[model samples]
Target chain A: MSPELARFLQDCEQDFQQALPALCQPPGSDCPAVPGGLAEAGAYSLGNGGKRIRPVLCHAAAAALGAADRTRSAAPAHALELIHTYSLIHDDLPAMDDDDLRRGQPSLHRAYDEATAILVGDGLQARAFEVIAGSDVLDAAQKVAMIGVLARASGMQGMVGGQYIDIHATGTDMDLAALQAMHQLKTGALIRAALALGGIAAGASEAQLRALDDYGRHIGLAFQVVDDILDVDGDPSALGKTGGKDAAANKPTYVKLLGLDGARQEAQQLLQAALTALETFGASADRLRELARYIVERDR
Target chain B: MSPELARFLQDCEQDFQQALPALCQPPGSDCPAVPGGLAEAGAYSLGNGGKRIRPVLCHAAAAALGAADRTRSAAPAHALELIHTYSLIHDDLPAMDDDDLRRGQPSLHRAYDEATAILVGDGLQARAFEVIAGSDVLDAAQKVAMIGVLARASGMQGMVGGQYIDIHATGTDMDLAALQAMHQLKTGALIRAALALGGIAAGASEAQLRALDDYGRHIGLAFQVVDDILDVDGDPSALGKTGGKDAAANKPTYVKLLGLDGARQEAQQLLQAALTALETFGASADRLRELARYIVERDR
Candidate 1:
């Protein structure tokens, strides 16, 4: 990664770190009415070390759309990070992915207890909306629109519902199409929303927003395909987490149906499509294109 | 409960039953692209039996605000119901409250799997917003406001946050103040939002909303007192579900702070306050006032 890209991610990480405590608590939670530890479980996962990819995509798109001053887009980007963290929290719960490890530590539910994990995920999801709506920068209409964007992606028509399908078919051998649909939901929905939120934050034009949406869609899938590839070929030490979890659980992956090389080829193809969508932006999209390339190329 | 209140409860239950399928699946989920078991787990909870108190509260408030037709408030009322159910689903998970039984039958997680319970709760939360946001009856602003109400009530600073305090403090004696704060998040927040969502759905005036908010706050705490009283003295057979679980778990309760008789008396006082709030509504508030009474007065 270039220093510029590293710097952008670092900036987002700092903003997310600062804004996170606000997102877990209910709005007006700063009042003494709420006791200490109200946000402890929520903090566990949000504080867990994970790359801020989705939030980075959001900030990058906002900056590309002439919100050149990164400071202006900080709040929405904070909300986006909360959404991403919430999804990971829920995904790692015993009922969902059942992973004992996330970012190389115990999953939220395991780290605390089951109820805490559930509430943490629930709290974070609600907090994400609260921050967006409570934000003074956006007008009511824009906040409402952003909430609409988020709700659709997080709800039944999106990630959560997608998770339901994945669990129901657990142990059932699914074909490639079933697998893709599941990944689109379990991974892609929020990625698409990240781009959508960025455009809304930057006040991008419809044409620019459309292009970013397409870009998000392709890379989102490619991101998952790369995850599948990593599970098969990447070194466990570099991944910083268990790499063979999917196959061990018999959760279907691209390689399960199409073979390891085939999945890598698919990721490459999707990355190319993501880059193609940014062709309209020319030099302005260099960062996004590079990010997409890194998403497909990363080992962990 | 009065005959009229009984009828209203039955009507609301029927409405939930009727709309259950749509609430379960993602809109356009039949696109056959996604893989979630939205229907099966949804049926596990929706097809089972439970009191529809939350939705009824929503409808009653909407009706009190003069949206007489159930169709007009179906979205918010149903959204409230789904969120309530989502809490139940998550609360029943193995890592949370871990109740093996609910509504006189197996809990959703126990009946299915932990993953199913998690996804079911996630799906319901998502579905609640989908129902409200996708509604044609309420304007976009109304939808956003309703989402905020639901999110705040159910999130960390609300129900889930309360659960965290409850679980974290398990096996230790809690002060009266700590117990009350826990219940405010666990039980009070949702009840408050139940009233608020109904009012928002009906586009209630500021004064009416303030009145309802007060009524909601008083009654919500009162309802918890009644629950704790039941945990101490009620008969499980009559209650139709387990009542001794709180005591067995050594969780804090109003009965623990105030004696059983004192808790009952407090409930009665809160009932009067709720009734006073409804004094201006004349006959339209009859059902709502009765619900406040029933929420406290019922043996369960």
Candidate 2:
């Protein structure tokens, strides 16, 4: 990996970790230090280490729009990661995936009781929008627009809607088109929202927002495709999660339908499509281009 | 009931029911109608008959502020009710209260599976914020502020925090102070937000907002006190829910600390305090004063 790219990711991770706890804590000093188990449960799920991909994407989109100050993007970046973390917590519930593990550790429901885990996910979801609503950096209009985008993506029409389709589709044969549509809502919508939020925060134009969204859709699907491939072939320790559980659960995947070679070829094509969406921008878009390749190539 | 107040409440209920379904459905025409079980579960829990007091309170607060158009407050009023419904659904989960009935029907988790109920609660929550963020009537700044208020009230420091305390406090004795604190967060926060949101929609002055909040806190406490009184003496069918369940579960209540007569006396005192908070306003606040009395006097 290039040093500059690696440094950029590291910085994003640091900012995400630092800003997240403050979001969950109460605003006034007189309030109790942590508010007990609900706060603890939220913090535990968020603090578990994972790839800070969404926040990095948000920062990258803002940088591409020529936003000079990284701090300006911090709230949206953290908010995206919070939303991502909350989804992971809910998706791993016993009633949902019934998974016992995530990020190479016991999942939130496993670490805490199912009730605590549920509240944690709900609280985190609320906190995500709260962060954006209370943001000092963005103007009111920008914050409102970002709120609309993020909520739609995370709510029914986006991630939650996708999840509803997915759980029902499990153990059933689905064509590529149905699978793609499901992923677009469940996984793709948030990825697209992350980019749009960054662009919105940076004051990007309507055309620029459209371009970022186009770039996001391709990478979003590619990300899920690579995830399927890793479940079959990647090392569990490196991946930081139990591998091959998707197939064991009889869930349909790109790897299952397309085979290894076809899935790899599809990933490359999607990566190219993503990079093409960023072509109008100059050197400022180099990070986004690199991220597209990374989505398909990351072993974990 | 006074004829004027009765008419006002009827109008608020109509607006709430009409606007709520539109909030759950997707925006674009292309998306599938109703989005299947998750959406169904959300609609089912939300559609069940209730008093619609929160939305009525919202409209009352707005009307008091001299807002000429009732239509302008519809979105915020409906959004507040959605948040209230979502909380009730989650609070009745098997892992939480383990209740079997709500609004005279099987509770959400009983009517649907536990998983569906969980998702329904989560989805409705996201929809609540989406309604505010997407409201065309309010300006972007107003929307942002409303979002912040609702999110904070529904989040860990508010409803969820109260639930956490209530669950832990069950089967244990509690003093009046602890009981008040729990009820304030659990029930009072959202009630307070409802009035504040209405005032905000009407562009109320800071002092007016403070007055509404003070009134909300008093009436919120009074509502719970009256609830405790009814649990012991009221008929279950009339209440549209299982009454006396709080005592059955060994849950803390004002009646548990104060005697039944004392609890009733406290309710009356709280009603006076609520009415006193609106002294600065003239007859415009008559609905609010009557609502406060009804909270203490209602049989069910």
Query: Across residues B39-124, which tens digit of lDDT does each residue of candidate 1 receive?
Result: 67776687574667677888889889888778767888887777788888887777777788887888887787787777777767
TM-scores, one per candidate = 0.92, 0.97
Candidate 1: Cα lDDT at A34: 38
Model 1 residue A3 lDDT? 91
Summarize candidate 2's per-residue lDDT along A1-300 as a digit string, tens digits: 678889999887776676676567766663333358778788777778587888899999999999886766777888888888988888888778887888878998889887788777788888888889988878999999998888888887778888888888899999999899999988998999999999998899999998999999999999999999999999988998888888998999999999988999999999999998998999998988888888889999
Give the clashing pairs for model 1.
A95-B115, A114-B95, A115-B95, A123-B156, A164-B36, A165-B35, A165-B36, A165-B37
Per-residue alpha-carbon lDDT of candidate 1 for residues A1-300, written as tens digits (9 for 90 to 100): 889877877776777676676555444533223335657667767777477788788878887787777654565667667777777777776556767888778887777766666677777776777677667676656666677777777766677767777776778989888787887777788888888888888888889989999999899999988888889888988887777778888888888888998998899899989988988886767778889988998878
Scored against the native two-chain complex, candidate 1 gets a DockQ of 0.48
Instruction: Output the lDDT of residue A141, model 2.
Output: 93
Candidate with best TM-score: 2
Q: What is the C-alpha lDDT profile of model 2 across B205-241, one tens digit per residue?
A: 9999999999999999999998998998889889988
Predicted complexes: DockQ each: 0.48, 0.61
Which 10 successive residues of model 2 chain A have the least lDDT summed?
A26-35
Off by over 4 Å in 1: A25-35, A70-76, A168-172, A204-208, B29-36
Question: In model 2, where do residues sit more than 4 Å from their true spots?
Answer: A29-34, B29-34
Clash count for each candidate, listed in order shown: 8, 0
